[model samples]
Target: MIVALTITKFRSFTIPFAFIGMAVLRLPLWLNKRCRFWKLMGSGKDAQVDLPADYRHWAILTTWDNRETYDDFNFRSFVMKWFNFFGSESFTILLNPLSSHGLWSGKQPFKTQISDINHTEKIAVITRAAIRFNKLKEFRSNVKRAAEAMRNATGFILSAGIGENPFFDQATFSIWENMESMKAYAYQSFDHSDVIKLTRARKWYKEELFARFAIIDSWGSLNGVEINTNN
Candidate 1:
């Protein structure tokens, strides 16, 4: 199974240094032998809770052939070099796809056995899409309410609004207490259902991807609180 290694950082007062250093570190990441696909992302304020844009926070989303491949880069690549120099706190999550559909930049970036939808386990969900130019207003109008629904939803852990570009391009990464809990919120909630239905019905996105993963392992903090990702 391939895995998604996503990490978000929260920097200290020296914002300029961390920002520039992170951007410069991408060259090394793109060249990493073990990494199959990757993205440099901007993140929201907190992970467990859905929040607005937080400039001090940024993230790295990448896929690897296997755990060892990811581990090698974690310790040996320039990605680590930036981590050492930044002095900010971060959290890294490893995920195994349970289910996935659609594409990311015209390609699927993950592969794993189909998940047991009824299984009770910690889970992660990622929703990424490039909003269509003509449908931008429609998409933008729906974001706030959907975010509120996520934050207050039952069993919700954390959710982050991230993107390659702010506003125009967007994605969400959220963790849940269990599959049942996540499904309930995603499928049963009115606001969320409306978002999903219209996204398909109106073709709100030019490109999009939706995936569910089992939390294989993780460490560190998302917003000063360490999460337990061993499942």
Candidate 2:
């Protein structure tokens, strides 16, 4: 099923550029080399826009075949190299089609489907971590497990890197089918609960942010889209 991935960062000029130079440039190359990588997911027709000055970083939106493909890419490429490079954070939100949609300067109204589910539910998972320099490795490990659990859970659609600068603490975004599925894995699942417990017990993060949104309207590329003003 096609899924949407969104990567955003807090405000910083140098940090985002560094990510562009390093992670962004290498990502397409890495995807090309990977066995399960699909086509680049984005809008080629429109000119890319700059992130607002008020915002720290821009959001990268893309689509994938399924959660498995996305997970493989993350484990093999992103977690190993990309995550370590920039102090970035991300949140992923799963989107279901609300109505017939189309792009490319008004073609016929494309018949829309959820791609995963029927309802138009969009859940966003946002996580940020602050770890002691000495415990960075440990923090990374824990976060990795949490991410993996999230991937394994049912109703997962897409997950992405959060911020542009991740040297100190990092964030991640994941999309889920519904709040119930998200809560089941995040709050009830065994391994995931352990990760959460460790995060709190060890004081791994200085601060974290999380919120959920229902997709009201979406336009643009899969890697990035313009959410509706109503949302």
Candidate 3:
């Protein structure tokens, strides 16, 4: 499957349209024939679990049927027109889903795939969740610790926090040197493990989606740093 992440930082004068465009982009995202699942999100100020956010920046994550289909929309679509009209800086990332579990909006966007990650592959993992209203405080409280743990985890490369709405629709996208290293962080880290356990016991998420992918390619900047394709 095709998973794409587009991040755009609107010019100060164009911020209003960026706000409006995010709401307007939803229709075409769902209506598009090739798109399977999509989310329009805001970004945290740092590349980890963060509280303060930058209203000037936004993100869009969508799953498409194939690479060519995504390319067509990326290069030629109403959404692209909006980006051109209202965007200043934008980055688009294309990925291949190696495996996925759980759900987003009650549906599993990516079907289960075998654990075929190779030793040389740079693994990309994404976790998206819509937090339950009552659990917001707890979720936020644990974020700093979890972010710290992740940042310090072995083989960790990079990561960022994103969401559709503040404190509610939250997600994290992190890169690892390989699948094994990612698993070690997910399963062995006490801080992360505690957060995961609390998520289940507390029922923090109203809906959630977890996915793993093999990095294909990326362009432009995320949080002002260019994506490193070789890593």
Judging by lDDT against the true structure, name the best candidate. Answer: 3
Model 2 alpha-carbon miss at residue 151, Å:
1.1
Model 1 misplaced stretches (Cα beyond 4 Å): 47-52
lDDT of each: 0.77, 0.46, 0.81
Tens-digit lDDT track of model 2 for 136-199: 6677666656666777888776555434334453445555667678778888888879977887
* Candidate ordering by lDDT (highest first): 3, 1, 2
Any runs in candidate 3 off by more than 4 Å, and if so which?
46-48, 112-114, 117-119
lDDT of 1 at 218: 84
Backbone clashes in model 3, listed as residue pairs: none
Backbone clash tally (model 1): 2
Overall local distance difference test of candidate 2: 0.46
Report how far residue 205 has shifted in candidate 3, in Å: 2.0
Best candidate per TM-score, number?
Answer: 3
Q: What are the root-mean-square deviations of the candidates from the true structure over C-alphas?
A: 2.2, 16.1, 1.9
What TM-score quantifies how close candidate 1 is to the native fold?
0.89
